[model samples]
Target: MESLEHLTPTDREILNKSWAIVSKDMQQVAVNIFQMIFEQAPDAKLMFSFMMKDYNVTDQDTKTRIVT
Candidate 1:
């Protein structure tokens, strides 16, 4: 596996800056990420208890509950 140490200083800086922005709304970011994971691999939902039931639920608040 490639190591993060291979990343240039500029690359690290970009990642840090992006993380700072993303951290501001981590809940929504988490939901979006998880949704993508489930969409890409439906079987991945079985790994999380919260996701095992009714994935079609559209309530943003309920979806974000998994992250919290």
Candidate 2:
């Protein structure tokens, strides 16, 4: 089980940027993160899910009304 403590400074900066951009739609962010993690470490999917479950993040709704 890899911990976030091992992230390099650049990695942390990128994560911070991602968090800032996706803060409003965290569920979507989680989904993206899950995919990324799976691609990087296929065995870590379950761990990611377990860690994220407590956050109450919901799946992104397909239908969203956007105003221009």
**Segments of candidate 1 deviating more than 4 angstroms:** 55-68
* Clash number by candidate, in order: 0, 0
Model 1 root mean square deviation, Cα atoms? 10.3
Global lDDT scores for all candidate models: 0.77, 0.69
Candidate 2, 1-68: lDDT as tens digits: 38888999999999999878889898988889878987898546445556554344334576433221
TM-score of each: 0.67, 0.37
Q: What's the lDDT of the predicted structure labeled candidate 2?
A: 0.69
